[model samples]
Target: METAFTPFQSLAGGALIGVASVLLMGLMGRIMGATGVLAGLLMPANLADWSWRAAVVAGMVSGPIAVMLVTGEFPQVQVPVSSTMLVIGGLIVGVGVTFGAGCTSGHGVCGMARLSPRSIAATLTFMLATGVTVYVLRHVMGG
Candidate 1:
């Protein structure tokens, strides 16, 4: 499958992520790790913790609606894989996050920004694994 080259969209999204990360850190002293945020929402320690996680999740879910309102239509998404593959990929990601202790938003953006050695290593590993996975899937498996 071919990947879409969306430089402007990518830049905008990255800027938004960076701004959100800084805001979350400044406001809550927390990293804007998507998986951690979701997990906290699912199994919160208290009502206060749950509330912030819920707000963050709500903002995440409503982004598409906000985009639709702005552009008069939802942003187009292209998922070339089957539903089965999507589910499998999600499961793999969940497993990876559990093992790696954080996701890309956390390790790559926030953690690396702070010069955390663990995050740097994790980010490098993530990129390398991603490259290898894509190569294997596209070139070797022809998927």
Candidate 2:
């Protein structure tokens, strides 16, 4: 099925993300990577560090709630797989993040913005892998 495309919304969201990244780096001296922030929360070394990590996680959780309150409806989410499959996919992604040293937001956005060669390579690998995975699932495996 054809999907609805909202260019304005997408552009606005991307701009917000860019601003957030810049602000986080400027004010906190931290990279705005969800995975890294969540991981830090799980294994914080000090109370001060833990507080910001907790706040980040809370803000992430509350973002959809705030949007729903403003819009008078929850955002549409389409999940094409079973819950078990979703959980498995999440676990695999966690493993991949660990191996890759960073997630997409970290390497693709922040790292590339800083002109890191490693991040550029990592981002390219991520895009290529995602494209190959989609091709394999949709055509080769007929998933």
Candidate 3:
């Protein structure tokens, strides 16, 4: 069988994520969503409203790098599809993030923690959309 993450490792990762989320919300009053972060960076107009976005983005980009340095074992990344498929999937995700008002990290973690109704709705939409997409790709499209 293929090697998989140990239970303790999974728990540690989850705990780290939870701690980081709490710290971000408590300190910066911001939701750690990569899509929104990147969008804000590209626009730069929104940077005036929030000064810490740069640091937040930097932390996100650096976290994995730091982990890699410590562990010395990079996770395997598999891309089973073509660049066109990847681009299409990315565009769809972007559209969903915009329409839902937040991505998975924002709604699934932070908003859910805060008991936000909009976040609940957005999270559900994201899940449903993901399920449908997977079903279509695997069964209907046979990809």
Local accuracy of candidate 2 as per-residue lDDT tens digits, 1-143:
33479998789778878898898899899998889999899999899999988987887788779879999988888888899999999999999999999999999989999999989999999999999998898889987
Highest lDDT model number: 1
C-alpha displacement of 13 in model 2, angstroms?
A: 1.9
- Give the lowest summed-lDDT range of ten residues in model 1: 1-10
Worst 10 residues of 2 by lDDT: 1-10
> What are the per-residue Cα lDDT tens digits for candidate 1 across 1-143?
87889999889889988998999999999899999999999999999999999998998899999989999999998888799989999999999999999999999999999999999999999999999999999999998
**lDDT of candidates 1 onward, in order:** 0.95, 0.89, 0.79
The TM-score of predicted model 2 comes to 0.92
Candidate 3 lDDT over residue span 1-143, tens digit each: 13355798779777877888888778877777767767777676764544567777777678667778989976556677799989998998888788878789888888899999998988888789789977897789876
Instruction: Flag the better candidate by TM-score, 1 or 2.
Output: 1
Residue 96 in candidate 1, Cα distance off native in Å:
0.8
Off by over 4 Å in 3: 1-9, 45-51
Off by over 4 Å in 2: none
Question: What TM-score would you give candidate 1 relative to the actual structure?
Answer: 0.95
